[model samples]
Target: MSALTGKVVALTGGVGGAKLARGLIECLAPDQLLIVANTGDDFNHLGLSISPDLDSVMYALADLNDPQRGWGLAGESWQAMDALQQLGGADWFKLGDRDIATHLQRSVRLREGASLSQVTRELCAALGIQHRLVPMTNDRVSTMITTEQGELAFQEYFVREQCAPAVSAFRFDGIELAQPLPELMDWLAAPDLEAIIVCPSNPFVSVDPILQLRGVRAAIQAATAPVVAVSPIVGGLAVKGPAAKMMKELNMPATATAVAQWYGELLDGLMIDVVDRELVDTIETKTRVLPTLMSDLESKVDLAQAAIDFARQLD
Candidate 1:
């Protein structure tokens, strides 16, 4: 195979997205790739600044993530959380000892006037991560899940309630006031920018917060580069998280076709697992069939490589 060319931007959130992101990191040079992680899941818990999605990608890229749990550091000890629970502290959101250090430092840095991006850069450097990883924005825009029980923050719905409530709608609180870092805006308009890959993350919470920002969708629509997305839905279920459940609750099909339709005409191509290949003809946009389940490092790399090739073909 020939060497890959041009810069690529990947929008990612959660474990599945981070797995593919690690694959892209292996395939592309640090300078050629930029990873934009969703920060909508960020929240203040026990007075610590917690960025769940960003930490997921960061920990995965740094080789510190717990693969089995799909979040937090590997072999993480939870004495802190255990003690907190004993003391009647807020333990709904479990915080491992090492993971708490990360939040502690991040909170201190943010209070010291470093932007979230700057703090993230410092953390990445300490962890020896090279590829560019940035929060969707430094500004606070939170993902609010509206459930049958009423409104709840993302962590509350996901962790506390264990995603038991049926989702009725989602809102990005403070999104109207949020703005992308100037450089990201430039990337959207950069003439030489090659392709944009929307990683296989939850459409409602993970992906929407980034795209719902003012002018982001418009920028994507106006960009010349081909926009491609790897479908989070496979067969009639989500590979991870509540993407499929939310789809059903929102009166949409829990299939790759529905995923493709959700992205609509914005995508130049949509990548689906081979299990859903039979549904390709039902999709409107250009489509590719490949195994998307990242069971291991090699499979993740393969899917990342295929997505890039698909983008190059569309280009």
Candidate 2:
């Protein structure tokens, strides 16, 4: 744990982010980490609200995550999805049976006028996840996809479209009206905050939405804690997901250097995988090299310890 006893760390995005979040959870007391999930991915499906990123983080933290799949509940069944398919519904997104329980409860709570943050907290408590898991906002903020084909909903671009669309642009609808969760802001200003770790999530889609929130980027910039990031791309490819594909489609190089450039001046240090270790010296920004992959619990713990050690070096 590197003696980072009272540090407050904020994380963003889904699977990639959640992996590091899980690592931190293993090493830190639950209260020491605050997860600021990207609510821009929030959407309504089959008349029910769904927050993919939030659910992934929650599932990962509760130790109920499916390691092989990288997302959703462990031992999940597709009963509801199969039934929905028989009824001619859009089962293209693949919502698992166990995962549906979360959506069902969240949907009911939301219908009763509870905020997303409130519902999330309740869900975390029920799952026995003691860390603070917060949505970027309780307000509506959907990530709209602008591609060569046309503007599509997030899931359509990601799942149905299989991320084949040539990237044009993206915008968070209703973001102008969105406010950062108060608790997140308070934590950002916490006296005990040691460093802010931007998990190795997709820079444009995953992390950008949270950065675009009204005062979020500014708050992160102004915070006293040093901010660090792990690159999702390794050896010119994404460790997982379509991050590298999106970068190429967006006319950017698929390299650790590109990831550093995307983050620009925001990060105090950048962590790249051993595969890209050679490029560390060529990176445009101040950075560090480490084995970024967390294949097992031991590796996750080592990565978490490396992060804290890196932060201490900055001090």
Candidate 3:
């Protein structure tokens, strides 16, 4: 395939989405790509602002991510978490020594009147990441997972509770009041914009929170760019995280078709794994069958290229 031209914006969540973001970064120049990360998972942990998805994307782009654990810095040490446990502090969420430094720096900057987007840009630069990375919104928006036990904060349900609760629904606490980042809005309005690639992120919590932000969905709908989504589910199961489990609990089928349906009319095309090729006939939008698993760099770049090529074809 020829070189991908024009600016492309990728909407991503934590690990799964970050993998694709890294692929896109490799496929395009720093100026040609922009990553909008989910900040719904952001919370104040141990009195420090923690943006899990942002950190994950940054780590991935900088080649500092721990592939084995699927999160945090590679060669990470857990001296802090170990000490916290010995001091009888909450140790459910493991924060490694290097990881804590990120949080501490971000927390300080945020308290110093820096916007989340500004802080993220600075952090990305510090990590030597060239491609632009922005949070979905600078405004505070928390994802609340409503489950059998009750409504719980995102991290409380995802990490502390280990995603054990059966989720019935989800809500973005401050989404109604949140505004899309100015840079993202400008990109959506740019005449030369090419495509919007929705990374294979959790539809309910990861991608939904960004969509629920005021005017974000409408902007994408109105943009001239064709929106394409990569399925997070492969062969009826989520590659990582609790997406599949959440889907089943919400009475939706744990299938690629269901994932497409959840995104609805916003999608111009949907990319499904080869294992889910059977779902093509049932999927409502235009479909592209490829191996969506990102077990390594090659697969991730190939899938990223496929998704972009499919979107270009739609044009």
Candidate 4:
């Protein structure tokens, strides 16, 4: 066993998740990490399969991430989106030129009969990212939110609608039929698996979708490794996205304590920001107060180190 080496982790969600994931990749050996990105936001746009979460994770790992925007490729140009706008197309989804290359390649591969996993692996290899990155499933499952405006796809509710719709409920369409990616299952079942870090992502839309997969929750609960979650909520606010608002709409407090409660008994430890240290004792799960915000590379690495240390101590 690789001692400090044999660790395996599975993460879901998008940019925020990717930030911590990049940090973890720096801390752990590449083979020791496995990121399971959320596909809930995935949808067909202009008859093309667009997977925002997966691409974000992949780009972040590949070191091609746009830090300023926090979501697409660095130094990107929006030619595709510009062209679509000129054609008077629905340009709600902005696909930059560099990012569009990734989408086009992925679309073409899928069209040629490649599974999402296979394409992801190929992309990872090409990008020189050594760690394993897998999608939640092989089947088409989308998170549809029932909001005041009506049922909106995750991206439509998030990106296009700017999350303006008051979410009444959410359903993962086709989740019942979605099969866990075999490679992910194999990694989860690995004997040396040491920890799972649920990244500081929007729990409702990001992590929840992955957990909703038929066997994923059960597998996580049954894993010999300890499961730790970093709270996206800090000081009654979300650092990146709409988690806080969504939580409030769901009648839950926008706090780390509430985030831990949402996870229920699934978590062995909850990583909260030092800003919310006072709420540590109030959390349902055991807590570790750290600087959870990944404002820069150092902060991200520090949080990742803290999480890995906590998990190792637990083991």
Predicted structure with the largest lDDT when compared to the true one: 3
Ranking by lDDT: 3, 1, 4, 2
lDDT of 4 at 99: 80
lDDT agreement of model 2 with the native: 0.85
Candidate 4 lowest-lDDT run of ten: 1-10
Candidate 3 C-alpha lDDT tens digits along 1-315: 327678898999999999999899878888888899999999998998999999999999999999999999999999989989999998988899999999999999999999999999999989999899999999999999999999999999999899999999998998888988989998888787789999999999999998888888999999889999999999989999999999999999999999999999999999999999988999999999988889899988888888778888997
lDDT digits (tens) for residues 19-81 of candidate 2: 888888777887778888998888899888999999999998888999999889889999999
Candidate 4 lDDT, 187-273, residue by residue in tens: 777888889899998898899988888888888888898998899998999988889999988999999999999999999999998
* Candidate 1, residue 307: lDDT: 87
Model 3 stretches with alpha carbons more than 4 Å out: none
Tens-place lDDT digits, model 1, residues 1-315? 216668888989879899999999988888888899899999999999999999999999988999998789999999999999899998889899999999999999999999999999999999999989998899999899999999999999999999999999999999999997666777888877778999999988998888988888889889878999999999888888999999999999899898888889889999999999899999999999989999888998899888888888998
Cα lDDT of all candidates, in order?
0.90, 0.85, 0.93, 0.87
For model 2, the stretches where C-alpha displacement exceeds 4 angstroms are none
**Which candidate model has the greater lDDT, 1 or 3?**
3
